[model samples]
Target: MALKFHIVNRIREQVKAQGDKTALRFQTAKGWGDISWRQFGQRIDDISRAMLVSGLAVQDKIAIFANNCPEWTITDMAALQIRCVPVPIYPTNTPDQTAYILKDAGARVLFVGDQTHADIAMSIAEQCPALEHIISFNENVDFAGHPMGMSWEAFMALGNDNVEQELQTRIADAAMDDLTTLIYTSGTTGEPKGVMLDYANFAAQLESHDKVLSISENEVSLAFLPLSHVFERCWTLFVLHNGATNCYLSNTNAVREALQEVQPTVMCAVPRFYEKIYSAVHEKVATANPVKKGMFHAAVTIGNKMATSIQQGKKPSALLQASYRMADKLVLSKLRQLLGGQIKMMPCGGAKLEPTIGRFFHAIGINVKLGYGMTETTATVSCWDSATFDADSIGLAMPGAQVKIGKNNEILVRGPMVMRGYFNKPKETAETFTEDGYLKTGDAGHIDAAGNLFITDRIKELMKTSGGKYIAPQVIEGKLGKDHFIEQIAVVADARHFVSALVVPCFETLEGWAKELNIKYHDRMDLIKHSDVVEMFEKRITELQKELAKFEQVKKFTLLPSEFSMTNGELTPTLKLRRKVILERYKKQIEAMYKKHM
Candidate 1:
C-alpha cells in the first residue's frame, strides 16, 4: 500500500471520488456536524488558497493552539499542501509554554481555536518577533496591534482564489524528506524542544502500522486524544489515508458519552484513560448489593476461567463452554454495551499500562493493547495484535522498524518513522543517535525470544536508594496500579532511607469501599482521612509487598484526595505524573511520611 504521508493532495482526490461520503464529523457548542469528502477537499483547497492569498510563504511556520477540531485539521492540511511546516502547541500548555514554542519555532502566523487561546496568544504576541498574523477560529475578540486577521468563516472566502495548479507545483516541492510538522516535546525539565518530523517519517510510521493492524474504510476512529501531540496527529493521518471515518469526541470531559454516541470501531487513548475505565468498572462491581455482587463475581470467574483455559490452548468441556457463553451474554455483553459495543481496539500509549489490567481487559472482550513509541519517532515503533498479546511487553517492533539492545540495556531503534532532528538544534539532534544513527529510546528493557519488546522502566524513571538498591519504579508502579482502589501512584524513593509511594486513590472507587464499611466523611479530603480508607490501602500495600524485594517494598505511603490533573502542575499534558513537581509540591507530606527531622 502506498503511504500518502503528505495528506493534502490525497484529500483533494478523495474529495473528487468520495465527495458525498462523510469525511469528518466535528462537534460544536450547539451540537455536532459533518462535511462530505468533496466539501472537505474543497475546504482544504480553500484554506490553502487563503494562506497563499494571505501571503504564507514556503518553509514558513504557523502555530495552531487548539483542541482537536475540523479547523485544526484543515489548517494543518493547508500548511502541508503549501510546503509549510505546521507546529501545534498543546491547549493544556500554559501561556508560558505557548510563548516559548511560538518564539522558538519562529512561527510567522498563529491560529487560535477560541477566546481562551486567542487571549493567551495575544498576551504573548509582543514577544514573538516572527508572529505577524493572527487567525481566530471564531469571532469573539479583536486584537490591538494585530497586522492581519480573519475569522474561520471569513478565511474560507480568501481560499476562493484560483491557485489549484500553483498549489500542486508547491506540493511537488515537498520532498518525502521535507519537514512537515514541528511537534514540541513536553519538556519535563527546561524549554520545550521542537521535534522536526518529515514527510517520509510520517509515511513510514502509518504504512508500517497498517501492515500490522487491519484498518480500512470500514473502520471508524472516535478520537479524544489531543491532536497537538504526535500520537493523535499521526493516528488521525493514518486513519484518513486508510479511508477510515473519524468522529471527533465531544470533549475530553464527555468521552464516555461520545463513546456511546459514535460507537467507533477504533479509538486512540492514553494508558491513564484506560486505567480510569478499568477502575470505574471495578468500582461498579465492588459496590453492588450482595446478590448483584455475587452474580458479577460468578460471571467474572466464568469469564476468566474460559479466557485462561482458551489462552492456554485447552478446549473446555461443553458444559463449561455453555456456562461461559451464558455469562458472556448476561454480564460481559452488558459491559461492552456501555462502550457502545463497537470498540474493536484501542491502541494505548504515552505511558506503561498495567499487565494485569491488560489481561483482564482482554478477558472482558476489550482490546486495550500496549503499543510503544514517542513524539520524536512520529509515534510508531512497536504495536501488538489483539489475539497474540504479551501482557508485559510492547509487542513486536513494527514492520520496517529495527530494535536492538544498546550498551547499557537501552533500546535502540532505526526506522523511517524517526524524526529528522530537533529543529535548529544540531548538537541536541546529533547526541540523540548512535555512531551508526539508531535512535536511543531512553527506555531500559530487553526484547523477548519471540521479538516482543518488554519495557522494564524509563531509563530516567529508575531510582537508586541511599543504600544503592536500584528499583525500576514503573515495574512496581504498574504492579500497584493493578489494584482498583489506588487510582494513580508515583513510587518515590530517590536518595531516601527507603522506598515510599505517593498514592492518588481512585476516589469514586475508594469512596464506595468506605461507605460499604460505614466509613463516614465530608468530601474527598475527609474521606481520604478516614481510618477505613487508610486501612484499605495499608492492607493493599501489605498484600502487594510480599511480591517485592525488601528494599523495593513501599515502606510508607500518603493517599491524595484527587486525581493528578493536567491543569495542576503535578501532571504533564500527556498525563504522565510529573514526579519532580509531585515531590516538590508534597514535600511536607513526603517528609511527614518518612518522619524526617527538619
Candidate 2:
C-alpha cells in the first residue's frame, strides 16, 4: 500500500473521493449526527486558517486539553496541517499537571473541550505566559471578560476572513520529518516526560499495523479511549486512513450503551474493558440453572476446540463444526451481543491481560488482538495474528521493527516507529536508548524460538526477597487478578521475607458472596474488614496462587476497600498500576504482613 507522508494529505484525498461519506459521528440530544469527509476537510481548513490569522507560525506549539470528541481530532489535524506541533494533555489531569505540560511545551494556543477543561486552562493561563489564545469547543463557555478567550465558532469566523490558499501552502510545506505531536507519558514513576513524535513515526505505525491487520472502509470504529494517548490516536488515524467512519463516545460511562447503538466493527481498548466483560459473562453464567450452566460450558468447550483447529491451520472435525454452530446459536451468540453483535476485531494494549481472558474472548468469536508498545514507540510494536495467535505471548514484532532481548532480559526495539526523542530533555533521551540505538523498553521479558514476546515484569519493578530471590510482581499480579473476587492487586516483595499483596476486591461480586453467606456490613470499608469476608478472600487468594513458583506466590495480603484509581494516584490513566505510588501509600499494610513471622 502506498502511504501518504503527511496525515492531512490522506484526509484531503479521502475528501476528494468520498466527499459525502461519513468521516466522523458524534452523539447529540436528538441522536447521533455525522460530518461528511468534505465537511471534515473544510473544518480542518478553517481551523488551520484561524491558526495562521492568530499570528501562529510553522512549528508553533499548540495544546489540546480535552476528552475524546470530534473536536479534539479536528483541532489536532488542523494544527498539523499548518506545520505546527500539537501537544495533547489528558483531560483527567489536574490544573497542576495540565499547567506543567502547557508551560513545558511552550504552547502558544490552547483549545479547551468543555467548561471543565476551560476552567483548568483559564486557571493556569497566567502560569503559561506563552498561551495567548484560548478557544473553547463548547459554545456555552462564557469567557466574556477574558481578552484571550473565544468560542470555536468565533475562532472559525476569523478563518472566513482569510483565503484558503494560505492554508494549502502550509500543508504543502509539511514533511515526514516534521514534529507532529508531543505526547506526554503518564509515567508510572517520576515526572511525566514529553515523547516527541514526528510524522514518519506515526507513518511507520500506520504501515507496520497494516502488515498484521487489515481494515476497510466498511469498518466502523468506536473511540472511547483517550486520544491523547498514542494507541487511540494512531488507531483513529488508521480508521480514517482506510476511509472508515469513526464514532466518538462523549462519556466512557455510556460505553456499553454506545457499543450496541453504534455496533462498531473495530475497537481499541485496555485490558480493564475486556476483564469487565469477561467477569460479567461468567457472573451471569454462574447464576443460571444447572442445565443452562451445563449448556454454557459445553458450548465453550466446542468453541475452544474450533478455535484451536482454526489457529493451527487445520479444519475442525465435521462433528466439531456442527457442534460449534449449535454452540454459537445456544451460547456464544448472546455473548457477542454485548459488544453490539458486529465486533470483528478488538486491539487490546496498555496493560497485561490474563491469557485465560484473551482465550475466552477468542473462543467466543471476538478477536482480541493483545499487543505491546509504549509512548516512545508510537503505541504498537507487536500484536497477535488472528489466524495463528498464542494467548500467552504478544505476537511477533511488527514488520520493519527489530526486537531483541537485551541485558537483564529487557526487551529492546529498533524501528521507524521509535520516537525521535523526549522534548527538551537530551540527557533523559540519551539514557532511553542503547549505544546500538535500540530503544530500551525497560520491560523484562524474553522472545521464544517461535518469535513471540512474553513480558514478565518491569525491570524497575522486580522485587528482591531477603532470601535473595527475584520476584516479578506483574507475573504474580496477572495470575492473582484472574479470580472474580479480586479487582486490583499490587505485589510487594522487595527486600521482604515473602511476597504479599494489597488487593482491592471486586465489590459487586464480593457483596453477592456476602449476601449468600449472611455476612453483615454497612459499607465497602466495613465489609472489607469483616472477619468472614477477609477469610473468604484469604482462601481464594491461596487457591489462585497454586500455579506460581514457591518464591513467587503471594503468601499474605491486605484487602482494601477501594479500587486504585487515577484520581487517587494509584493507577495511570491507561489503568496500569503505579507501583511506586502504591507501595508508598500502603507501606504500613505491606510491612504488617511480614511482621507476624518476625
Best by TM-score: 2
lDDT of 1 by residue, 116-175 (tens): 888888888899889877788867756555555657777768765477777878877767
Q: What TM-score does candidate 2 reach?
A: 0.98
Q: What are the clash counts of all predictions, listed in order? A: 0, 0
Q: 75 in model 1: Cα distance from truth in Å? A: 1.1
lDDT of each model, Cα atoms only?
0.81, 0.89
Segments in model 1 whose C-alpha atoms lie over 4 Å from true places: 1-5, 141-149, 301-321, 515-523, 596-598
Q: RMSD in angstroms, all models?
A: 2.4, 1.4
User: Which stretches of candidate 2 lie above 4 Å from their native place?
Assistant: 1-3, 161-163
